[model samples]
Target: MRSQVITGGPFTGRHMLIVIVAFFAVVIGVNVTMAVLASTSWSGLVVENTYVASQEFNGKAAAMRAMASSGISGDLLLRRDVIQYDIHNRDGSPAVVDDVTLTFRRPVGDREDFALALTKTSEGHFEAKHRIEGGDWIVETVSRRDGVTVMHEARRIDTAEFGQ
Candidate 1:
């Protein structure tokens, strides 16, 4: 019985090359998959409403920060008579706020979410025709600017009719 090792040009160094290539393919594939899962918007997983996104919230945050940092003041006025709420971009130019959603838990009812597309009425004024029952509500606004979103919320006593 005899054991012999044969070294050949076609099969000798090629095995190492083949193994390297295969390993790289596997590594690249796994990395790509992980990147997609990890980088893809994590916002959707935060809630059950698959169709809704928090883009507006990001914009609201930018707006809020910009509003704060710029020393440029703006207001969310919940009008006394109409219970009408208004938001001002007030950042000097048109902002990329796509949507504004108001979610609230009334003084007595279960939490409910209402949404409306905000339209810029003027340089910094964004308006929407929304009417709601009066109550102490926690408001959250979802806004999008430059591919990012923000949810800005303000709390208030809808006292326009609370005492009535």
Candidate 2:
């Protein structure tokens, strides 16, 4: 017996329709999932007002430059039960500052963000008794002398275990 030639292998208009619908369904499903995750994870707000931030950019840049030229720097320490920062001069000696304030923020979100006012422990060493959660952090430190801002520093750090 001779084999009969097939007109349609199996794919039909119905199959084509299903295939197109399934492809789009998958794409739309993935897009919705991604959008939800993104919206929940981060607010995506860098500044409250872009225009205001832009207006002050130049002055902030100048202040930062002046701070850098002054050769003043600070070191931050995160321990299990305390947070510490030490300021130094260009000559490596302790730089005396009136106040040291720290703002700890998450890399992506502001839910767990907090600020601490460090008490001067010694000449240039400031300490704050706050156990920061262990994770990635962006720490902003501001050192002031007689109500004048001396140094402004922002740094990223990862901690294995803090306040544990």
TM-score top scorer: 2
On the 0 to 100 scale, the lDDT of residue 2 in model 1 is 100
Task: Rate residue 163 of model 1 by lDDT.
Answer: 47
Cα lDDT tens digits for candidate 1, 1-164: 99998865565667989999999999999999988876652333345563455656687566778645543323455543232334444554444454445555453434344555556565435655566556566555555555564335556546454442
Best by lDDT: 2
lDDT of 1 at 152: 54
lDDT (0 to 1) per candidate? 0.54, 0.92
Clashes of each: 14, 0
The residue-level lDDT of candidate 1 at 122 comes to 52
Q: What TM-score goes with each of the models? A: 0.40, 0.87
Worst 10 residues of 1 by lDDT: 80-89
Candidate 2 wrong stretches, greater than 4 Å: 1-9, 161-164
Against the true structure, candidate 1 has what lDDT? Answer: 0.54
Task: Encode model 2's per-residue lDDT on 1-164: one tens digit a residue.
Answer: 99989675688899999999999999999999999999998999999999999999999999999999999999887887888899999999999799999999999978999999999989999998987787899999999999999999998888863434
